[model samples]
Target: MSPRKILGWLRAYAAHDDPLVATANLVALVVASNVPFYPVYHLLLIGRDAWPALLEAPVALIFFAIPWVSRRSGLVGRTLPPLVGVANTLFCMKILGEASGNALFLVPCVVAAAFSFRAKERWVMLPLVWLPVAVFLLSIDRMGAPLAPFTDAQFAAMLRLNAVSTGIFVGFLGMLYGRAGIESARASR
Candidate 1:
């Protein structure tokens, strides 16, 4: 399908779906986009212990499922993405170690959650936000030895890659939410 057609389809899809579904789709796309890069990430490690990176494929599929599942449950749609993100990042960080920088993704999880819900849903939003922070806090002192034997230079590269990627995701989120805020204000006028 053409890029225009695909985007038009997404625009139409966003129009009909509950607002939560849009966030779910965004989360899905982010995860799915990284799937192809997993091999490259493994290559950076000189091809050692590629299995942890392999786990992201199923996680992406799981993320993609959120929008479909949201048709039936808003709670699931809003809750699953960050929860799964926290779980996946924690799992990857544990095996890849802190130096691999998988832990940085938890920030995006918090940002995604913050944008996914409204103030009216503060009770629900509270847990979604806290889960990532909680996971980070609990794991801070517990991260184990690197399972892949990535050299110090490899670790530094991984940290830089993840940090830059996280910044980009957050910037993307700002653009999305910022435009959304403008649209909402215009609608209310």
Candidate 2:
């Protein structure tokens, strides 16, 4: 297919109001966000420990593959959302373990789940995305010091900042989706 056609296909795929599409879009967003960070982490004098940031690309690729494989194997409708939710939670834990202060990554998955899954499914996913992180944060002392290079104050600040930013992002996405739903409903009527 031509590049334009391929791009159009991807756009349509992502625009679908389905759980699988949300999962794919979330993975794609992570990959897109990570790719540009590589150069900045390497060239800029930000910090030496930013190397782990590069792992997000491959991780997202792996997560992206899950939905594709499950779809091919006829498991998309029954299983994809929960699987993506678990994977997202694991990734959040990995970030926490790495002391990356990027736990905010969970927010997008939760937000996407809101758009994609039924209310019951979202209830399941919401805890999966948050509970582990809450436990990890609470047991930080038991887990020993963070491996990230940041000092205690810096780490705390980063976590707080991530939380605030994630809240804003979730609010924005909620408004945007709510508006779209209203518009579509009106159009249908």
> Which whole-number lDDT from 0 to 100 does residue 95 have in model 2?
46
Model 2, residue 175: C-alpha shift (Å) = 4.4
Cα lDDT tens digits, model 1, 40-107, are 77666546554556655666677766666666777677778788888888977977788788899999
lDDT of every predicted structure (CA atoms): 0.73, 0.49
- Under the 3 Å rule for N, CA and C atoms, how many clashes does model 2 have? 0
Query: What does candidate 2's lDDT look like per residue over 98-186, in tens digits?
Result: 34445454565555445543454665446645554565466444444334455555456456655675576567556655665565457
Candidate 1 residues lying further than 4 Å off, grouped into runs, are 1-17, 44-51, 184-189
Residue pair clashes in candidate 1: none
Clash count for each candidate, listed in order shown: 0, 0
lDDT for predicted candidate 2 compared with the true structure: 0.49
Model 2: residues with Cα > 4 Å off, grouped in runs: 1-6, 15-45, 66-100, 119-143, 152-168, 179-189
TM-scores for the candidates: 0.83, 0.55
RMSD of each: 2.6, 5.3
